[model samples]
Target: MEFYGKGNLWNFVEEERRNMHFTRSLSFSTDQNVSEPHESPFVSPKASSASATSIPLSPMSPETPWKLSPMHASPSPSLLYHCLASLHRYEGNVFSIAISRDFIFTGSESSRIHTWKRPDCTEVGHIKASSPDVRAILAHGRILFTTHGDCKIRVWDVSVTEKFRPKKITTLPHRNPFFLFPKKNSHQHKDYISCLAYNDGEKLLYTGSWDKSVKVWNIFEKRCVDSFVAHEGHINAIVINQQDGCVFTCSSDGAVKIWRRVYGESSHILTMTLKFQLSPVNTLALSSSPSSCFLYSGSSDGLINFWDKEKTSGRFNHCGFLQGHHFAVLCLATIRELILSGSEDATIRVWRREEGHCFHSCLAVMDGHHGPVRCLAASLEIEGLLVYSASLDRTFKVWRVKLLTPEKAAMEELVVTNDQQTEIEECKMSPVLSPSWVEKKIQANHFQ
Candidate 1:
């Protein structure tokens, strides 16, 4: 079957894997070469076993506790940050990222699965299946739902622990897979499934696919509850606000449609539409707040547009726009009042919402990768303190806002002092003597 954007899609996935392998191999080789004696300059001499194992103690009460005076205390930095580890390396650019209560999940083009621990970013498991590429992943209750390029959606029962093993349960076939592509063997028929959303309270799974349709599935019954032709072109994204019983979908045809499902019905009734003709909407995210009722959507044109549900229509109704990314904006996440956006320009931007519907200027521009950032996930458990991002570079990065406590500050000080003392001792043990000492010894030898 043909697929829309097939060239770009295949290249994106292949580039990711190639970059990941290249970087890992380069680092490994560099470390190996640096281990040789002539290549390393900071190697320490082997220490005597007795000296290494022994630590002298002052004659003080064994139970005595150390106390710090107020004068010795210092203010700590508001945040500390570091890259813990890369979660997974994909052959295709990761298009979606989701974090459950315990595990981190990502969808990539190689038709493979990648998972890691929440917040820690430790690799847990992976699966390579026959599905066309996966575009989005949603975790609801014990089940994880994924949308793919094969015009099918799969449901998996995932273990909510460190092991992260997911068992495939059901696959919902597309009702109108042919709608995705008119020509057989055409590149447009690959049927890229772009988004997945679930209403666990109602036991429903909703998927947006390139077939230009949104499908609702009954999770318990393992059957499609309802299917609707919601877009004129490929449905690139979909998000369901279960709290409000509202589902939002966007397509390459350049429009955002909102559907409201009646409390007891299977079909979704169309409510409203937000139209933009310049670019296709690539991602969508809803705010948790009610009064603000804000929804953010990123587009292929690199502008992050904010829409307020309260404002119905017309020129003055737009909320605001985030303009910084040089290329297309691919993904977005909301953590409290902050909004995070990942772009094809190879940067992740953080923005904060201020009072009166306006957002503060960019809070931070995270940079470290050489390729486009394809997906981003923020920890709901950490109160907007940690962020995880996946890129076309074939790596996932975990970032945290460092919160330094009194204990951590003291430990850092102690570490610095110990390092300084070690450097001083090393200086004293050096083989070269001072010129003054050598001259005095030569004078004494002449007198003798």
Candidate 2:
């Protein structure tokens, strides 16, 4: 037993060393080895227990005492990303993710949604909706909404957490209406519920499904209020702009449509139909800067279409494109002016908004997940960002990211800037960098 504080220097050092050893063990036991400074961004499929590279980004400064290493060795002009934690438990691909004030929810192909504590990846509870895949999740006041491949929308009352069990309040369609009314059957969605959105003020929930239909439900009533075949292909995602009373829906049919509620009419009007998109729109995000609000749509291809409100036309017009990801942009997350996109190429790209323009520059590429990234959630912190990424590889990782904090960034900019430095240059010069010679240079640059 030992005390910890200013006076207990030896005890603190011993505790820190144990923590370092524990973290290293977790990293190595999680089915991969530590990555070298050069061979980063992607963990090779051939990684073994014997191989290693665990370098934390926070240089052992007096202010901080922990381990972290940048996931991308290639300099991002002025940014760096570090892995904070990695959680692996699901048996299949992780499809969707949601972050609440107190919990983190992840839906997967294993037919369950796993719940963890907000600050750390501590297992708290889980709900097995059915034998089919849970494709999406939404957190409201006290209820958790989940869309499943079994073509159903399940409402979970999470307030009743007696034994980590959330009660399934009701399923849509309320059993079958055939007994009540033959024509109005109990069939809610014929295919799958792909996405969900909610409007707090209106007290309604919107769902998009693979049946090429969008359905509106009164959460309090647990009944489908309206249903319409709104797309030609399977609906991919839905997002609500409550301030403008706009419902944006994306589909595999390669189009995004906007709907608005009429004052007295029971049905919503199709206000706009965005066309000319050659690829199927897969996800949608609303980004707000100090000056304006913009809508971003991720596609089956690697392009993310940017649309801004046209003051003159009073409609959303195509502003430009944020083109970075090489494969399909599966998910998108926005925090203030920053945009994060996860793609089918098994990497996440961070982009910083240019303040006044619709275009954005790629800041860093995080390559740790071995499968296509399926979902991402980001929350702003006082100094940086806490980002969570879910992958089809059956694991979700938490990352800590900040831009331009190291004194060595300016000098290291010219040393290693891209992938070319990893293979040809490092192999050619590695033979000359001896242990003593490297140690001398590292000590001389202590400020880094």
Clashes of each: 14, 5
| Residue 153 lDDT, candidate 2, scale 0-100 | 80
Kindly report which residue stretches of model 1 are placed more than 4 angstroms away from their true locations once superposed. 1-81, 87-90, 161-165, 174-190, 311-316, 380-384, 402-448
Residue-level lDDT tens digits of model 2 in 162-233: 445567787776675546644434548887787989987788899898789988888887777778889998
Tell me the alpha-carbon RMSD of every candidate.
17.1, 15.6
Q: What lDDT is reached at residue 8 by model 2? A: 30
- TM-score per prediction, in order, is 0.68, 0.73
List pairs with backbone clashes in candidate 2.
34-53, 56-68, 56-69, 57-68, 57-69
* Cα RMSD of predicted structure 2: 15.6
